[model samples]
Target: MEPAAKLDPITETALRSLHDIVVPAPVSWWPQTWGWAVVAALLVFAALLVTLRRIKRYRANAYRREALTLLEGVADKLRHPATRPDAIRELAEVLKRTALAAWPRDEVASLSGDGWVRFLDAHDEDRTGDTLERLLDDFEYHGAEIVAGLPSNVCSDLVIAARRWIEQHVSA
Candidate 1:
């Protein structure tokens, strides 16, 4: 026996049409969305890199400025003839150590002989000329030489040379 419910031909056709229209095929937009997200992430990464480079440059400049100030102060002290040789020697050592800190300690600290001479020679401040190297070398070689008295003028000249070198080589 057939069930009492029977669909008319017109109703059957409409139901079939509605079923096809209402049921859509699945869509895949996940890949497109991920691509856009990746692009945004790259943009953020580039911005951070630029910012870090700028910060590094700023720190380098600051370090150079501080080093210059210290060099200038030492030069000013040297101008006073009353300053003792021991004091001047101490100042020179301070300058050398500061340079090492600015540059590489292993390279500068291990430097000696003519290599050291050339290093100082490259600066070429008249006051700093041969005398500065001699004083430094003497202290390194004889330690006792540090106690010897240094002329006020010599100390002043060394300071002048150091200032000139710092101004020329150090980053602004």
Candidate 2:
């Protein structure tokens, strides 16, 4: 059997006509929540911190970048077989100038021959500086004498050593 209606048929009909089915209220987008604000702030701060660090590092390593460019020029100079001795001389000068610029001039300027090589080896991580020092000894002293030509392999080795020295040495 059906249960009896709590309201009269007339009252039920009247209420149904007045309103449809109920629903949840719609959400508004006017105001941002605290969590979202904090997240946005943190993201901005992290981005700024990264940018500042990159700038500082770029500034600090400027000398290394310049030295690498000069080393590239030395490679170009070495391309002509006839110019190997002059290129070798130029290579030593570039490395010396780069080191001198990075450190105190007095400490680096007067150093030559094995003394210069030892200084370079002291800064080098690979310990191949003695080989490079030998090249400087051979080429720098005999830059004008083209009769005793330096081997192509030796010149190339000097280039590699100079590149490593410029890249790996810490400014002191």
* Lowest-sum lDDT 10-residue window in model 1: 139-148
Query: Candidate 1 clashing pairs?
Result: none
lDDT of prediction 2: 0.80
Candidate 1's residue-wise lDDT over 44-103, tens digit each? 999999999999977766655666677666666555544444456556665566557566
After superposing candidate 2 on the true structure, give the runs of residues whose Cα lies further than 4 Å from its correct spot: 1-47, 143-148
TM for candidate 1 is 0.47
Candidate 2 scores a C-alpha RMSD against the true structure in Å of 6.4
What is the clash count of model 2?
A: 0
- Per-model lDDT: 0.62, 0.80
lDDT of each residue in 1-172, candidate 2, tens digit only: 9998699889999988896679988887644688987888899999999999999988988888888898888887776676766777788888888888788989999998889888888888777776687776766776455513656677677788888888888677
The list of candidate 1 runs beyond 4 A from truth reads 1-58, 76-83, 123-128, 138-150, 170-172
